[model samples]
Target: KGISADVINIHTIKPLDAEAIIKSVKKTGCVVTAEEHNFLGGLGESVARTLAENNPAPQEFVATQDTFGESGTPEQLFEKYGLNSEAILKAAEKVIKRK
Candidate 1:
């Protein structure tokens, strides 16, 4: 659990900061993308493509799988869908191992 990670806040998905992503990957040698959206065509996919083209590295995604949504409090929903900090830490650990 003594791993250091770079957190890039990608505000705009359309204009994804590919350069920043690549830079972080170059330094960390791995990546974990955490998003509230579905895992398929979201930030994870975009970052994956960016890494595949620029610098390939082990990656993990902490996003909700493609499934029907359920109504709940934001905390409950995040916990259920693995969109919480614990999930992100687990993903980071997994990806670091791959490196």
Candidate 2:
């Protein structure tokens, strides 16, 4: 939480800002993309593809993996679908360690 942050708000999804995302990944050399949707065909995958094609960096996806959502409180849903901070951290670590 104390780390410096440079946030970029992407309001448009139909026409994603691939260049911006690619540039950000190039600068950081790592990325953690989070979304409420499923991992497949989601923003995380889009970011990963962009980075892969442009800069090829360590990218992590924090989203529901090939699963459907359940009706419950936000926290409950996250816990049930493994979309919590711990999962995100684990994904980041995995991506970073990938060869």
For lDDT, the strongest prediction is: 1
Taking the tens digit of each residue's C-alpha lDDT, what string does model 1 give over 5-88?
A: 888999888899999999999999999999989999999999999999999999999998998899999999999998999999
lDDT of 2 by residue, 1-99 (tens): 222323456666658898788777666667877777898998877777777777887777778879766799999988878788788777666765662
Report clashes for each candidate as comma-separated counts: 0, 0
Against the reference, the lDDT scores of all candidates come to 0.93, 0.74
After TM-score superposition, what is the CA distance of residue 5 in candidate 1 from its true location, in Å?
Answer: 0.9
**Regions more than 4 Å wrong, model 2:** 1-8
* Backbone clash tally (model 2): 0
Could you say which candidate leads in TM-score?
Answer: 1
| Model 1 misplaced stretches (Cα beyond 4 Å) | none
The per-residue C-alpha lDDT of model 1 at residue 71 equals 97
Candidate 2 local lDDT, residue 75: 95
Model 1 gets an lDDT of 0.93
